[model samples]
Target: MKNITFCDQYGQLGGGQQVLLELVKAALENRFTVQVLIPEGPCADKLETLGVEVRRISNCALTQGKKSVLDVMRFAMYNLSVFFNNFSVLRSADLIYVNGNRLLPVAFFAQRILGKEAACHIHLNHGKLEKKLFRIFLRQRRTSAIVVPSAFIQRELVHFDTAFDSPKVRIVENGLDARFTSTAFEDRFSSRPLRHVGIVGRVSPEKGQDVLPALARRFPDMDFHVMGDAAFSSADFYATLRRDSPANVHFHGWVEDLPQKVREIGLQICLVPSRCPESTPGHSFEAAPLVPMQMAALSCLVMVRRLGALEDIAKSLQLISFDSDEELIPMIESLRVQPAGEPLALCENSHKLAVSRYSHNSFHENLKGLLRALIPV
Candidate 1:
């Protein structure tokens, strides 16, 4: 078997981790021997059931919140342990595939020692330290190539770093299971008012969780739902959001059954407030924008605050884009009162787009081909 050892930045379950799970499933179905390097958490149990060998690296540096000298030393010690402990797998694997940029340094280190082929799938577009880390990947030779989920990342890579002028990078758009796109949502709720509007994902400052409460205050009658939990986020921010939240705004923390929850709540519009999580203030990149796509695939109307990077995928979908809070309020109000005829038509159109564009079958084929090319038998 051509063994491919996969790695994730965190084994804690999240959107990216879920995608990693899907990739794990694909790798196995393709008949490759698969292994995973991750911090021990709930995700390990899931990966284990899938029959892949799981290697746990204790207390990863990427998840460390406070930056201090001791923290740096601790991170170094753990990484050194990872390099030595997982040496057998690291050195012998046909390919080392890491999930995100945080693990690129570790991948680079393993590649240098073993001279094995590797791929780093970067899900985010821009970070100040990205160029420095990516430059090291190119010069070091072991990291092999970069795989990105969107054209926004490919563009950002070229614009920000000189190393990308070579053929060391490829763009693969994120895909969803066909079940979501094919789901038949009978318009039973269409007759009801478009009362429930919300955002979905981790509750963090950059993710716009705190902004939801104030947005709820603007319209007392309409209920605004914040559907997520605060993990790997600022405690104070989560606390602040709850403190000021009014009677109408509800925070349902960490929803697992999203489709069921959407049905129960009668969610009419989805507000996706995202930015380039890695970029500086006022800077955003073209990311794949996972949640909005999911909602659209499920035949829900969406409104987004995005520009160049996500514009291409979202352009064909019937999503309202807003540049500022000023624009969002009026739009939300209009959608709340307006007849459902237009939004319903847009939702149906988006379902068709979602089916053609983001199929899991295509994602797996692209990934298998990428891995095969990297590790030639």
Candidate 2:
């Protein structure tokens, strides 16, 4: 069996980390010797429970969202220390799988020095500096694959840098686990009129959880549920959201079984108000967010902002999408007043689309095929 060493920048169970866990499980199932090098946190703990080897590493201290010159310098110094400390682990592995961009530079360096093959999974859109850095490192000969979760991200990368247009780039859409797909269709929608809305994900500036308070204020009769906690340096933002939220808005911090909880609350609509700055080509903050799909899989109507891969998902799933808060307000009003049958039909169709197109089995098989191809005969 070929030994694959996976490198992740963070140990938290974010969207990218969720993808990593699925990939690790796939590798183990396929009889590959899998090991993960990540900071000590929930993700590392999860990997250990899966019977995979986990090695603790230093966490990145750089601030989230935007980084200053000092932050970049400090992060570079940290990366140097990480590289020196983990050189032997990476050198001994047949392939280096980088789960996020923070570890790309180190993986590229290892590929050049040790002649090891490398695959990078790009989960988010990057700023100008990050795009430039990715272009420089990904052009190396030893890089085997550049994986993207959506065609939207693939287009954005190639649009920014033509070098990404090469054959090495692969689009592997994210998927929902089998449990979600197997959920009973009849148990999804409630018989009563749907009035509650939900905004799920990390409460960060980019996630635009702050937008929910205003939305809640608009619809006083309806309750808005926020199902997530502040993570990845967004604690202040979460505090602000709580302080500014209206009386109708409720905050449930980090529900472990989000799908079941969402169902229990009987949330009919999930609003994804992801921010996409004009300065960036695509939605740099959110590329292929799984929350929308997860809600869709649970037979909930997902309304999203017309930005980045969200638009792609919306189009594919036939869900409602709005360009701004102004459009969203009227959309929510319409949903609140519309007949139950209409919304239920939309939810049913979206669930079907999600299950058929983005199941965990397909995700595992595709990822396994990609990795197996990298192994020699």
TM-score winner: 2
* Model 2 lDDT at residue 27: 85
TM-score of each: 0.91, 0.95
Error of 2 at 146 (Å): 1.0
lDDT of 2 by residue, 41-149 (tens): 8889989999988989998888665688999888788777777788888888888999988877678778778898888888988777788877876788888888888
Candidate 1, residue 188: lDDT: 28
Please report how far candidate 2 places residue 23 from its true position, in Å: 0.7
Candidate RMSDs in Å, in order, are 2.5, 1.8
Give the runs in model 1 whose Cα sits over 4 Å from its true position.
61-75, 276-279
Local accuracy of candidate 1 as per-residue lDDT tens digits, 1-377: 78888878676766677778877887776788998998887677789999899998775654323256776676667667777888888887888888876666567677777777788877766565666677677666566777777777777778887677667787767877544656674462366876788888877766766667677889888888888877656667788888889988888988767888888888777887765444255556446667877787777787787665557666856567877666777787777776777777877777777766776678767766776677665
Give the alpha-carbon lDDT of every model. Answer: 0.73, 0.82
**Best model per lDDT:** 2
TM value for model 2: 0.95
lDDT of 1: 0.73
